[model samples]
Target: MEYSWIRLLVLVACLFPALVECRVRHYKFNVVLKNTTKLCSSKPIVTVNGKFPGPTLYAREDDTVLVKVVNHVKYNVSVHW
Candidate 1:
């Protein structure tokens, strides 16, 4: 039983990095200003690519993603994901 567990551990350690790695996805996020009046009053708001809820990002298992955000407005911007 112990020998089988050791073998399994070794197999997992060797094959895990090779099966899910080396995939890097680059995404560009443009923070711009837009006016929204969907619910009530119209006001200027910040958005990514002119979307209210930002943009949809997709990734797979063990994938590396990099997001580059460019600020077009006169405000300090920060992103959390």
Candidate 2:
């Protein structure tokens, strides 16, 4: 009974840091503007899915990643490897 309690306490202590290191993130909204017709030809640069740099990523050191990106924009979106 006493040995079981000690083992449980050790397990909890080891797992606490792994849980706390994960962070939560939120982004603000954005709007795009453009002009058309016979006059000054103006174009607006907009964010993909209302995000400039896009989503926040979290990972530990030396972790393998396999992710797919889906573009919702009418134009091309570039990501450097």
Candidate 3:
């Protein structure tokens, strides 16, 4: 009985990450704002695609992270981890 319980525990531990969700999605807006000091400047703001706060995603730990970022603005954008 003890051995069986231990085996069960090990199985549960191995599957825990799979059972849980941990994936996340984030979006931002790239804008060029003119500042008085710089004469003209541009900055990137956090936005979910186009909406505020963007979108919410969930995934399990150790899971592969796959994200697709599309730029709607005219300026070139780059993202770094």
Candidate 4:
């Protein structure tokens, strides 16, 4: 009887993660290098979609956000949330 109870608890614990509901969101970003005179210098700066500050990412609770970044610049770029 004790063994059956232990087995039931283990089964519920294993299946708990599968019972949760979640959604996934996807986004794409293109990285490029452009020349601009923003800080008193016309230097080439790396930006995403031609923007310096990048874009705003929105998501809800229990929702997963997946972003695909493409780089076209000569330098390395790293993006994080």
Candidate 1, RMSD to the unseen true structure? 4.9
TM-score of each candidate? 0.69, 0.36, 0.37, 0.64
Q: Which stretches of candidate 2 lie over 4 Å from their true place?
A: 1-45
Query: How would you encode candidate 4's per-residue C-alpha lDDT over 1-81 as one tens digit per residue?
Result: 999999999899897975667889898899999899976879887888888879888887789999999999887888766
Lowest lDDT 10-residue stretch of candidate 3: 29-38
lDDT-sorted candidate list, best first: 1, 4, 3, 2
Inter-residue clash pairs, candidate 2: none
> Model 3, range 12-79, lDDT digits (tens) per residue?
98978556665554434333323222436655554434444455555556656566676655667565
Q: 35 in model 3: Cα distance from truth in Å?
A: 20
Per-residue CA lDDT of model 2 for 1-81, tens digit only, reads: 999999998899897856554433333323332332345655565553455555455555544444455655566666554
In model 2, where is the ten-residue run with the lowest total lDDT? Answer: 27-36
lDDT (Cα, 0-100) at 31 in candidate 3: 33
TM-score of 1: 0.69
Against the true structure, whose TM-score is highest?
1
Q: lDDT score, residue 37, model 4?
A: 94
lDDT of candidate model 2 versus the reference: 0.54
